[model samples]
Target: MNYRHAYHAGNPADVIKHAVLAFVIEHLLKKEAPIRIVDTHAGIGRYDLTSDAAERTGEWVEGIGRLWGKPLPAALEALVGPYLDVVARLNPDGRLRFYPGSPDIARLMTRPGDGITACELHPEDGASLAALYARDRRIKVIDRDGWLVPKAFLPPKERRGLVLIDPPFEERGDYDRLVEALGAGHRRWATGIFLLWYPVKDPVAVKRFHAMIAGLGLAKCLTVEAIWRPVDGERLAGAGLVIVNAPFTLAAACRAAERPLWEALGVANGRLGVTGDAA
Candidate 1:
């Protein structure tokens, strides 16, 4: 209940997550049909990088900070452009001050007819999120437990959309919960895209997670991982996303963008991979 993302906003994990998210959303936008976005565990939509919490951690220094204004290879430019465009709009002055969370990213990528439902469990964060989008008719903010999101809102009216499940693993057994939630959601919305995010702290736990998902019999599943450092101790060494029903072109785009992303993030030994049939 006390997990706050302000300290880690715009960090390496955010970079990878948002980059993939941007690519996915851009792909979805290709179709003329209106799409919906459901962000479970959505934090405050926008964050000020100069805030006290951000200053204390300064995590962005190793994340978006390194990528700002940096040139990218031709292959990666298209894949990562949408995300960087959003960040650029937020910091038009060319100084990185504000950082957008998943909800904000969705808002930026979505078209007029598309909609978003963001669920934030933290009371204060939820309030801030609601306030941030109060005047935006396309967005709906909900203050509730993210775990119940599939039950309350699945099989969206659009019938074509994305579900981003990014839970803060502050509680024990969160990994198990994530798998269960995804399975349940998949059952209800078989064709919908599902992106489940997790930290790569314990390799064993991550392996178990992948095995569990693999056993689910999902025909189209891809695991994208960005490992910046060795997995050790309690600190986060990397981030991962299990993408079910991924777009056909997403895997190739991710592969091409991996090296450039790693270099931009200043990680010499960073690793990126796409596993499962979708790859």
Candidate 2:
């Protein structure tokens, strides 16, 4: 995979994805039960915003940087505390220098008794991730195909868990892979939370993805899309996040968060919406 999350680590898209991810994971923490997180396509655990890769992209300036100290919508503010707190921990005195990837977020949320598994196919990122999170016993970093692992390790021993399928959509087969993986995973563990991230470049792919979700017959599947700008030709200018077996209260929070996120991003026609169960 040519996609290295370092280039886009702290971008607007990462802000939305990570914020929501933290929200959902925090919501899962209400119970006294232990939780496990499986992060497929997990990139480097953390990124230094000052690094050459991040400086070259400078996407964070348009993303998390804009929302740093601003007042967030109540829904988002409430749901994103755990995530923001970790982000805060990474930057003492409230300075944004390091941006945490999915694995970092998982490690942050996981308690002493919790467990985490991160899979990365990219060699460099995988190696970096292993090194970054090496000291955390609760976390396991693997250089392997994420799609295959879900089949091998379904219904985690902890029983309560989340599977994040964040593949690099650098190829056409990714959509099919997502659907196929979701279908197989759902069949294996219907109750396990599954999150799929995809780029919103072409309307055709978006519609097809929606149709796939609709046909899944999952009572609680939810889809959220946030577009920063109108599509330029057939290229993606935004992203979509789909959660199967989503939390009871997350949909409303996501809907309510749209306005502020769009406003903060300073982008026109920035749209966000919910599909599927209201709860």
Candidate 3:
């Protein structure tokens, strides 16, 4: 795969994905017990919006850009504060320039007892991720296939934490691979939280995928999404997340954070739904 996340960094998909990510990590941090964070398919830990790649897309202009300093409603702010806080920290001068990937978001939230494993299969991205946290003892960067990480790194010794699988979907089998990864990981760590991301193109295919996951028999799960346009056909309509063993409060939180996204991005017909134990 020749995908470099930099080109799409801070786009609408990322806003929802990372917002939910930071939200979940913050929830995991509430416990004093050591928690492990594994970011499979972790991209370069951080991004510079001024880079040539980011400039080519300018997707951030409609993403984090719209929300940077905008005043938000209380509930929405509470839901997305954790993520925006990281963005704010990266832009102390009150200018949007830096964006943190899943690894960086989790790395900053980690306490001494908490540890993070960031795995990136892309060669250059993996090396960049490794060097980004070279001095950070709490994070261990691995260059390996994320699809296998769940099996190889499941049941984290910490016994409690999050597993983030955000593949680029550059391969035809990625959805199948995600299903297998979740199944493999759950078998080893039934209680560990698992968060996965997928694009909202092809509504029918998306629903079929959701049903397939429900059949996997996870105890508790929910699907949260934001659809800016009609979900009638295949296109980059929006973004969605499938979270297994999610917090009881996550669905409501996801709902709260999603609308503001459409509002901020000036998009229409923001459709959000698909929350349930397995559906």
Candidate whose TM-score is highest: 1
Whole-model lDDT, model 1: 0.90
Tens digits of per-residue lDDT for model 2, 1-279: 678888888888788788878988887788989999999889998999999989998989998888777776675675456677888888997778988888888887768999999999888988998998788889888898998976888878998888999888888688888988898888988888898998888878778888977777778888888887777737567898898888878887777777766777788678887777733
**Which of candidates 1 and 2 reaches a greater lDDT?**
1
Ranking of all candidate structures by their lDDT, best first: 1, 3, 2
- Whole-model Cα lDDT per candidate? 0.90, 0.83, 0.84
Best of the two (1, 3) by lDDT: 1
Off by over 4 Å in 3: 232-234
> What is the TM-score of each predicted model, taking all chains together?
0.97, 0.96, 0.96
Clash count list over all predictions: 0, 0, 0
Q: Compared to the true structure, candidate 1 yields what TM-score?
A: 0.97
| Model number with the top lDDT | 1
Candidate 2: residue 89 lDDT (0-100): 84
Give lDDT tens digits, candidate 1, residues 1-279: 878999899999998899889888998999999999999999999989999999999998899899888777788886678899999989999999999899999998899999999999898999999999999999999998889988999989999999999999886588898999999999999989999999999889988988988888899999999888888857788989999988888788888888888877778988988887662
lDDT of candidate 3 at residue 177, scale 0 to 100: 80
Q: Score candidate 3 by lDDT.
A: 0.84
